[model samples]
Target: RLLNADDPFRKAYPSESPYFTDMGMNTTIKQVEKVDDQTVRFHLNNIDAAFIQNLAMSFASIQSAEYAAQLLKEGKAGDINQK
Candidate 1:
């Protein structure tokens, strides 16, 4: 959910978002949906052959939304580089 622009936390910190920018997954994904507890569906805007390959890169990993929530609750959302 953190990657979703409509999500509250993402909206609160626009500059800090790893999504919604050219350098991020925004260009590859047209939309996203939660399929279930263990599944998510990405709707692509176009057929890009390199999409999966790009996702395989280290920076493409999706961070835990719950962890992000924790950061927000603890007022640490601004520190994006913190592990």
Candidate 2:
């Protein structure tokens, strides 16, 4: 899958993908509990170091139920094409 590859897509958007946005992904950051102007706790699924990295790159998505429904409508809920 593309996540395991060194493809341009991986390089361009390694963690949270912008390509998904083009496919109508929701990239909204609704709430950030700011510890300071430069520090905030972001609510995200799959919490990990890479999640922080993805947030720093401005590529994170707050996938609401609506987005999930859209993905299902696209018939690509489980298909991740690497080729």
Candidate 3:
């Protein structure tokens, strides 16, 4: 939901902004699909060998949709990206 036109795909690096791009989300992820309650599918831009390893990193943590939606409703959407 966050990867819409307002935040479209673009290259970013840790040096540029650690809070936003240390894990290279902009260039690496092509799309995301929630297959089921326990599974999520990621459409990657390339065959990344370190994809799993990258996901193990702290920056790759997934946020809860409920909390995100709540924040959006409360007009605190900007806070969602403040990690």
Candidate 4:
């Protein structure tokens, strides 16, 4: 819900941001599933050797969708520092 374009957060923010590139969402993510309230599953289009490592990077930080939506609502979305 957060990463997909169907949500307002993804729509407000660019798919590829300077802070982090959503490589899987851009290339390898064939599908996403909400397994439970605490879990989400990613179905990759192909094998990715660095996928786990990339996900562990600080650049891959997850931001609050509500905050992002608020930023966009206030027109302060672009004011966010990528890093």
The best-first sequence of candidates by TM-score reads 1, 3, 4, 2
Model 2: what TM-score? Answer: 0.26
lDDT of each: 0.65, 0.43, 0.62, 0.62
lDDT, candidate 1, at 20: 35
Q: Kindly report which residue pairs in candidate 2 clash with one another.
A: none
Better of 1 and 2 by TM-score: 1
Name the regions of candidate 2 deviating beyond 4 angstroms: 1-30, 58-83
Off by over 4 Å in 4: 1-25, 80-83
Sort the candidates on lDDT, descending order.
1, 3, 4, 2
Colliding pairs, model 4: none
Candidate 2 displacement at residue 41 in angstroms: 1.1
RMSD of 2: 12.5
lDDT of 1 at 14: 43
Residue 73, model 3: lDDT of 78
Q: Mind giving the per-residue lDDT tens digits that candidate 3 earns over 38-83?
A: 8999998988787788777655667788877776677666555463
Q: What would you estimate as the lDDT of candidate 3? A: 0.62
Error of 3 at 15 (Å): 12
lDDT by residue for model 2 (2-71), tens:
2334533344433555543453323333344769755557554333444444444433433345655664
Model 3 ranges off by over 4 Å? 1-25, 81-83
**Per-residue lDDT for 1-83 in model 4, tens only?**
33455655455456544333445445766777889877778788899988777778665566666777777788776434352
Clashing pairs in 3: none
TM-score of each: 0.64, 0.26, 0.61, 0.57
Indicate the residue-level lDDT of 13 in model 4.
Answer: 57
